[model samples]
Target: MSDASPVHFIAHFTVTDGDGYHNYEKRFFPVLKPYGAKFITFDDNVTVLEGEREAGRTVIIQFPSEKVLMEWWNSPEYRELAAIRHQATTTFSVSVIHAIPQR
Candidate 1:
C-alpha cells in the first residue's frame, strides 16, 4: 500500500480490572483528538465465525494514514494510557490493518 493508505487499529482483549480499564476508556477520546483519528466502534460481544479465536471486547479505530497512526501509537501520551490498559486487561491481540489501495 502507499503511504497515504488508511489504517485501522484493531484490538481484542478482556478487561481484568474494570476500574482501570474504565479510566483508560474515559480519557481515550481526548488524547485522540489531536491525532486525527476516528473511533469507529467498541463491541464487547464479538462473533468469531471461524477459527479457534476466542471472542472478547473488540475495539476498532481508524486513522487517515499509517504514518499518522504510528505517530499516535508511539507517542508518550498513548504509551502512558496503554500502560493502564496493559495492566488492566488480558490482551489477545492488537493489529494494524492497511486499507486496500484503489485500482
Candidate 2:
C-alpha cells in the first residue's frame, strides 16, 4: 500500500438464513459498490466449532481511501438499501481501517 493511494481494510461477516442470502446479494452488493473499491473476496460460509453449526457469509472490499468510503456510506442512495439489509439480515460485521501510510 502506498501513501499516495490510501488503502482500506474492510471486512463484512455474518451468519445468515440460507434463503435470505439471495436478497442480500441482489440488494446489498450494489450498495457496497459505489465506493470505488476492489471487491477482493466474498465468502458465504462461516464455521463454528463450539457453538451450533450455522451458515454465514463474509465480504471483503478494498477502497482507495477512508474519505471515499465515507462518501459512499453517507450518500442517499445507500441509505435506503442499508435499511433493507438491516431488515433482511440476522447479523453482520462491516469494518473499515486505514492502511498505514508509506514513507
Candidate 3:
C-alpha cells in the first residue's frame, strides 16, 4: 500500500427521522472499527463555495486503502447497519475519493 494513497468515504445524508438516524449513528462506530476505518468528521455546517448548494449532513471517513474501504463497505456487518441508515435517512450521495499524494 505504500505506493498508493488512502481512500476517503464521503457521504451526504438527509435525515428524515431523527430517532432512527440516531440509532444508526450509535451503532456505526463499533461496526466500523473492526474494518480499520477511521472517522474523520461529520459536518452539519456545510458551505457551498461554488455552483450549487446541497442540503444534508456531510460525513467523511478514511480507510488505509481502497481495498480496505471496499471490504468494509461490502462486509455483512456494515450491510446490516447500512439498512438502518437506509430506513432513517435519504442519502444524497456516497463517494470514495482517493487522497492526493503530498509533496
Give the C-alpha lDDT of model 3.
Answer: 0.87
The lDDT per prediction is 0.89, 0.64, 0.87
What range of 10 consecutive residues in model 3 has the weakest lDDT sum? 1-10
Badly placed stretches (over 4 Å) of model 2 are 1-4, 13-21, 46-55
Residue 21 lDDT, candidate 3, scale 0-100: 92
Q: Could you give candidate 3's per-residue lDDT for residues 1-103 as a string of tens digits?
A: 3524689999998888899999999998898998678899988878778786467899999998888888889999989999999999999899988876566
TM-score of 3: 0.88
- In Å, residue 70's CA in model 2 sits off its true spot by 0.7
RMSD of each: 1.3, 4.0, 2.2
Predicted structure 2: lDDT: 0.64
lDDT of 1 by residue, 29-77 (tens): 9889898899999898767687776656988999999899999989999
Candidate 3 error regions (>4 Å): 1-4, 101-103
Runs in model 1 deviating more than 4 A are none
Q: Which has the greatest TM-score?
A: 1
What's the alpha carbon RMSD for model 3?
A: 2.2
What residue pairs clash in candidate 3, if any at all?
Answer: none
TM-score, every prediction? 0.91, 0.66, 0.88
